[model samples]
Target: MSEGPLYPPPGAPTPEEPAAGPPAQPAHPAYPAPGTTPPPAGWAPYPGAAGGPRPGLALGAAHKPGAFALRPLGLGDMYDGAFRIIRFNPKATVGAAVLVTAAAMVLPLLVTAVLSFTVGLALDESGEIETSASTSEVLAFLAAYGSLLLSLVLAQIGITLVTGMIVHVTRAAAVGRRLSLGEAWAATRGNRWRLIGLVTFLYVAFVVVLVVYVLLWVLVVALADGPWPVVVWGLVSVPAYLALTCWMWVRVYYLAVPALMIESAGVFGAIGRGWVLTRRAFWRTFGIALLTVVIANVAGSMLGFPFSLVGQLATVFTPEYALLALVLTQAVVSVVQNAFTAPFTGAVASMQYLDLRMRKEAYDVELLREAGIISE
Candidate 1:
């Protein structure tokens, strides 16, 4: 009946690990011989399981009494277990997403403003605009707007990196290690440029796909002079974009920042290393993220509902309230949407980071041993 701080609650433990400890050393009359089958459902020599020996020590658990047990949380197990995490560990998921989204909101505004002003200043002084209405002035406008656009894209990519770091922290935190935004930020300090390059590469690839799509649509429009071909093109394009969306996500999302933060991988090394880790685990990664997104969207809807109702009423009845209504809607969307959803994105990223590291490093097991959750 006791599920202490470390002891898993019901549904947490697998059926094998008894509520009580394992048998004593002398309780065993016989040990298995080499090259022979061990016990049914073989037990890994977990360092700190009940009746288990410490590190480098071996222990066996009996299953149906015939075959050796497989390792806990191997790839197949992790794939199956990911949803269990989303159901049980949602707090970690959102906590991670929010940190990243908040950074996106705060940092980009400052970055865009500063970069825009610098470009405007350059246009006045050196871009060779004879007057404010000149082409250089026009370029200045583009620069300012482009800065904003670039800022948004950059924020998205940075959030991905943040996702990786948060994942790293969550994995550690699950094992009773303390973690914080400051620690995650410190881990990201020098890695920003390489991460940016990775983001840029993926962005360019998407842009090229989009451009090709646009051209094909334009050609279709010119030739058919009817809407049906255009409609067909649009239909085909949806899955094209979906595939690419999943591509950049899987290839580069966890690769850059998580690899660096958790595995201490270098910039280029992180890319190759990430691919290696993610190649077969795409759906597991996607499922954990997809669940986070769904929960965040639901929570965001709950948060936004009130504001949306007020906004609708404001604009419908009050003609003079137009400006006020518009601003209010914007405020409502930001306050509600970001507040509820950002953290969820960060947390999902965080959990994914933990799963990756646990598979690669078994740090969780070591951590369990150190925390006395498992025996030495």
Candidate 2:
């Protein structure tokens, strides 16, 4: 009342002065405090700023502290962010991919080596099967073929696991955090089995679809009165089957792994989540997936060509160690090819998942909050 005390009254806890040093900067300099001076003209507001534009409202305002901006990504953004994720944390992305690929190739390499050697020994100098070939030789070849199939199944399982791991890594990168391989692996603990089950179920469904298609074709052939009917049936059904398969893959299966890993969903739940996310966005999802596949395949083929050429040359020059040389070279090719392709595909899928979530659910707000770029 008297205005005598300009400051705190006696015994009142006075505000402490800041420590003597340069002024502490805001955690996010881009997002200036509310009611403060607005940014200069043409200055885009930081993403998730108070009263700032939401994702679709102003994509230019989106902030990117990690792999991608916290907004719906364009095609270029998706591709660029995929590569950024790989480059940002190679230890978790590419390194993990290489290790998984090598491990997956081990049994396949062994089986191929054994098969080649057995078949080689069974043949005469002219490379014709010997008339005196033993039953064991034939059995060895058969067993090796069976083992090769088993190895392929195991390799697929390994790839599925690594896909989940890459999803985890991408998630961390989105939040501007770098996850180590062990941390990514740890993040996938409970979801690994779910991922495996999801992949297995998809494969089984694919096989069932093929079997049914084949059976229907057989029935068509059996019932047809002429070869013309058979030809007509094939002409109509082949493209339909292929279209259905591609549709299922792009619209239904593409997002399952990200859903499973990010949402901790069950096998079927993740599948349904993917289906839901793709609603009204089929073309976008399909385009992104198709482009990613083409890029990965081209890169993989390019990387594998040199190794393949070397293997062929080694086989031509050193016929005695041809099998071993070819096996080793193929294994190397697999490691190198998958090391690049797997992570790239996984990152693209993850980017798609984030983009979908941001478009549908305003997930950028949550992501920004989690990343500490915005206050809760």
Candidate 3:
């Protein structure tokens, strides 16, 4: 090579300097020195560092440029992160939830009104069923009922879309970005059908399993001749059925939607990914999921209680308009419940997916790099 200049080129290491290699191991292991790795974009220096904390170094602990620290999350982190995601971007989370919930409920509400009207036509002024109902009225009533069922199916699809959107919102928030409703919608658009398919498959499978269990219970009861046999079968079979269903629900389906949304996995792929992620962590995953559901449900019920009480009072005080009052109250309750619980549950599921990946796949390092806190 040509003779080197008096000093190394501006960016090159000199003789006394060691060539850049893996970052130096910090003296404290947990808190790396600020200078070693650049801080995440917009990150402030840790207080009391030599000059100031480096841009990338976490102030006092783990780097958390978003809803949570870039490390395996604790239970508190999961819950807090869920709330933070919604708070950080209400337009994407709660606003989308409200719109989706309202849209999903619309058809059901209309079908309910039609069914109520049709049924009312079949009832005499005395509130007794008319024995001479015409074929047209009967068909209309049946059609309304059929439409109600179809609306319910469509509602399930809408719920799936909301869940997928929330997953995207949580993912964006994790990277310190707040997605708008339209952005979240765009992010999830490609995965909507896959999510719906996954949910439909799960629902159908659950129904099939329940039917089989019921048929088996009936057969067992029919084959046995004594009351003691039925009681004994109920005692053993019911617990077994419940346990099996709960286990499958937790181990197989708990993380499927998140996998589908985040990994762009197909229906079966999402299920398989969920199964793999939960391997050797069944109890942990189940406990967290169950607790989240319980908390969401309890909070929803508490929030809806006022409306429910108002509905009850309305019915008691105004019998003539009782149905209208109850329907209106129920609608309000449903909106409030869905708006709050949907996002909360979706956030928890997203956080769980992230936590599992970090724990098992060293995902936090990748996240740090993606956040530009470190070089490739």
State which candidate has the highest TM-score.
Answer: 2
lDDT of each: 0.50, 0.72, 0.70
Model 3: colliding residue pairs: 38-56, 39-55, 39-56, 40-56, 46-53
Highest lDDT: give the candidate number.
2
TM-score of 2: 0.79
Badly placed stretches (over 4 Å) of model 3 are: 1-58, 108-152
Q: How would you encode candidate 3's per-residue C-alpha lDDT over 1-376 as one tens digit per residue?
A: 0111111111234224234454322211134465666544322211121232225434443367567777888899899789877766677788877776667567646754665555543444443335687777566556655654565466557767888988877765665545656667766766777888899899889999999999998898889988999998899988999899888887778899988887777899889989999999898988998999999999999999999999978767765444445556766787788778989999998889988989998878766655545555
List, residue by residue over 238-280, the lDDT tens digit for candidate 2.
9999999988997668999999888877889899989999999
How big is the positional error of residue 100 in model 2, measured in Å on the Cα after superposition?
A: 1.7
Query: Whose lDDT is higher: candidate 1's or candidate 3's?
Result: 3
- The pairs that clash in candidate 2 are none
Candidate 1 Cα misplacement greater than 4 A, ranges = 1-165, 223-237, 254-256, 264-268, 316-321, 360-376
Q: For candidate 2, what's the RMSD? A: 12.9
Off by over 4 Å in 2: 1-62, 108-132
